[model samples]
Target: MDLGIAGKRAVVIGGSQALGLAVCERLAQEGVNLVVFARDAARLEEARAHIRRIREVRVDVVAGDITSEADVDRLAQVTSETGGAQILVLNTPRPPSPMRDFLDETDNERWRQAYENQLHGALLVLRKVTPLLIGPGWGRVVAITSASIKQPMPRHAVSTIFRAGVQAALKHLSMELAAHGVTVNSVAPATVITPTFRPPFHNVEERVRAVPLKRGGRPEELSALVAFLASDLAGFITGENIQLDGGQTRALY
Candidate 1:
């Protein structure tokens, strides 16, 4: 099961801990050099050390918030200095709150922040970094978005709205980048247990109660899917939102 991406450079946003770190470890296992980005410098260092322990691949850490344009610019500059990256994992942090109903979202500022942080900020990174991939005529853009894009959760309004927009943007980018041999796709996971898995609406047991499997997905399980999508093996796949939910989402598409 050689992914055929060994030694290739990848830039993973929010790669400090939890699912991001899991993705990094999987990529490192595949021998991919990494540029892991997050706001926490200390956690980034810890992730670097942990990944190095997994494999001897080059692991560079960049501390920055994706919501900040200046930080994203700095990330691109640093990545370019390291010979640029062929794979870009756009994994930003979730919206501030656990979950909120659309009608209850009275504060207009929350909507603005969600747009900036979840949707626009991701595009900022893509705008700055996708060019690096274009030059090589080979690229992978796998965004770790939520399953709400397909099956919207009851109380999750902010994340669903912005992430669905992000999905649409990626689909558009897929067609635009097809000629360049670059694929743009997203992984939508529902109830994946990570450090920040707490949703105010439901606890772990209650969250997976409706799922046919009666269990939440594991981080490594989601990470494996990400690693595959980021490899040459998934070269033909693009403009798709593949869900990693354990029969939780009923929608066929």
Candidate 2:
């Protein structure tokens, strides 16, 4: 199944490891050149080598936190140099560890940080990259969000709040950019196995029991959907938040 995106360039945020890296590998396999962005310099280098092994596509890495405008500016600069990217995958940041109850999370600062990390940071990336994509008259923007936005978990309130905001923004952008041949959509996953779920973050066994599939989703599984959304095949799909939760989320819509 040729995705018809070979030779196109992509900017993958949080592409250093786990689901993000999986997306990077999938895109590389499709013959897409990559600009892998994340905060870890060493891990980014490792991901670059790993993707290169998958195929001979150009894999560049930029180390910086998405919440920092300076870092995103640097990413935009790099992307501009080699021609604008046709695809933008914004992998939402990992939720804070030791998930807290809504009432127990009394620290206002924590809420602010959540907004900064998820919503504000997403806007920053979108602002810097959308223009690059707009002029091309062909673009794909896929935001990797959380299923929690649809089925809110008490312990994961912070993540749900900001990610929902990101979803709203994507919905609006879908129509705003439709005339430019750009599609904006989101993929929400829950109980997905990723490096971000290390100890102190989530209990894998406990969470899987709630999923009808009785298992956590694999990174590659989620990446496959992302690859589809970023391809020409998904051009008609926009303003939607598709869930890859293994029947975990019961929302009818």
Candidate 3:
């Protein structure tokens, strides 16, 4: 289906690899110009180059850690130079593995970092880009969150906690922003095969067993939803947390 988002510009955070890159590809296919943000210069370039090869849409790569306020300001400046973005794909950052126990609550530093990465960083992006979008009185902000928002995971306590907070905050922002002709929403994926952000399932078999489909989700599959949400067709949709988890999420809502 034609997404009807051609000639529009978008800002994609955490676009260095995996699901973020997949979203970039899908948007590019819709003829959307892109500014992909990441921390690693090398990986960011790689992603940009890959998208450039596949879709003719212009792709700009910016290297900066989103957790830092200064970096976010700098990134926002660079994004505005691209004539501003109407679509914002907010992908949550993956904290390090061997993560400290959330139940234990031993490491306050880790907990602080988690909050900053997931919530503060995401809000900064929204604050920066919302103005650009409001100019045209049309905006789409689709966040890549986790299914833990509904069902908590023991192994991913930190992510589950922080991601739930992110989703809650975004939902409130959605209602407030919708009046301005801007929509805010999130997409939650279960067992998606992204390199750094693996589902906390025990093993390959265990992960498959959790999903009714008996298989893991692929990056491209989730990206398809993001592309659709970022399009004009999804203008009426807001404050929703849509899931694509191979039937993994059990909750009906």
* Top TM-score model: 2
By summed lDDT, the worst window of 10 consecutive residues in model 1 runs over: 195-204
What C-alpha lDDT does candidate 1 achieve relative to the native structure? 0.90
RMSD to true structure for each model, in Å: 1.2, 1.0, 1.9
Q: Which 10 consecutive residues of model 2 have the lowest summed lDDT?
A: 195-204
Off by over 4 Å in 3: 99-101, 197-202
Q: How high is each candidate's TM-score?
A: 0.97, 0.98, 0.94
134-212, model 3: which lDDT tens digit per residue? Answer: 7578989999988888887666787788788788778888988888899998899888876754445236667767889
Candidates' lDDT values, in order? 0.90, 0.91, 0.84
Better of 1 and 2 by TM-score: 2
Clashes of each: 0, 0, 0
| Candidate 1 lDDT, 1-253, residue by residue in tens | 9999999999999999889999999999999999999999998999999999999999999999888899999999999987899999999678867567899888899888888889989989888888889966899999999888898998789888888889888999999999999999999988889877874634877888877888889999999999999999999999988999898778978
Ranking of candidates on TM-score, top first: 2, 1, 3
Give Cα distance to truth, residue 87, candidate 1, Å: 0.4
Candidate 2 residue-wise lDDT, 127-197, digit = tens: 89777888768999999999998999878988888888899899889989999999999999988888776
